[model samples]
Target: MALNSKDTAETLILLLNRSGQGDRAAFAALYQATSAKLFGLALRILHRRDLAEEAIQDVYVKIWHHAPSYRADKAAVMTWMTTITRNRCLDLLRSLPPEHGLNEEQSFDEWASDDLGPLEKATSNSEARALLQCMKQLAPLQRQAIALSYFQGMAHEQLARQLVQPIGTVKTWIRRGLQVLRSCMGAL
Candidate 1:
């Protein structure tokens, strides 16, 4: 039950090394040390505890199965594990429908209910927040296009069809919308 502090660095390294070499006990220790934090991260993005927990379980399962594929020099164990968790979350998002799927425009407000507690505020950079605010300023159509393209896995043609617009119009809106968002975001 050691926290992942500097004091546990050596122990973590030992566990990672052993886990890489097929040691189940060391792998279990690694999961115990990091699952909570990883699940918290997933919950932040996915906004569902059950989904987050399932994602966390899937992530660790993959980690155990793929320990030997990890490269220590390429990333710290936590970073690698986080990447795995993020990919799993994205995959799950992709598999879902828009409301169920990754709709960037889907406000967290909809997900908030009496049962859900306040979301922990992530320490985002001021610049990033400003940029997000600027994106929020776009016309609803333009914003929808961008959100659909970036978050909903929709291609330009797909978005155009969905929006009942011409392909060129969708492309133009995305380009113009991005430029405006960038300039506005940068100024903030």
Candidate 2:
């Protein structure tokens, strides 16, 4: 039967709880339901379909392995799953050498291409706008570093080269930039 958001959430909670208790069917159901959204999240951030798909698969593997450790109160099941998806996407992004091309089927320019419609839902939210405004307040260099590392999925060394700065400076920029962003977001 089709489920409303509330019903879906209840179903998810039940499934996640069962998965946490080592129920494979519940875990499989959770993966089936969340994979598309999780894949979209990774694709937007990684800008590579294959890598994002891989990240989604890897995330499910991890969720299966670590289902028992999930803490429901800390975040909704979707949020927790998205966090795992994001982390795996970032980790894979970091592992690759800079300039590694997405398979020839996809154009490289997609890096700047967002799934804007879906992202707008999140980005236009009050919290996201506040964070964006705070990000705008950073120095150009710091902002670039932050964007490259977080948004473009570049590692520190890659960000350093892209920005034409030393590795130390790149790290400093990212750290300081994040500190500012945290303080700014916190204030809002």
How many Å off is the CA of 169 in candidate 2?
A: 4.0
lDDT of 1 by residue, 121-164 (tens): 34233443455567556666776677556433578988887778
Q: Give the poorly placed runs of model 1, Cα more than 4 Å off.
A: 1-10, 101-188
Report RMSD (Å) for each prediction in the order shown: 7.2, 5.3
Error of 1 at 61 (Å): 1.2
lDDT of 2 by residue, 1-188 (tens): 22225677678878888988989999889877777677877886677788888888788888877778877677777667777887888888778886763344332222223322333455533555566667666776676566556555678877676767899988887788889888988887
Q: Candidate 2: misplaced stretches above 4 Å?
A: 1-14, 22-29, 73-79, 94-126, 151-153
Clash count per candidate: 1, 0
Alpha-carbon shift of residue 44 in model 2 (angstroms) = 3.5
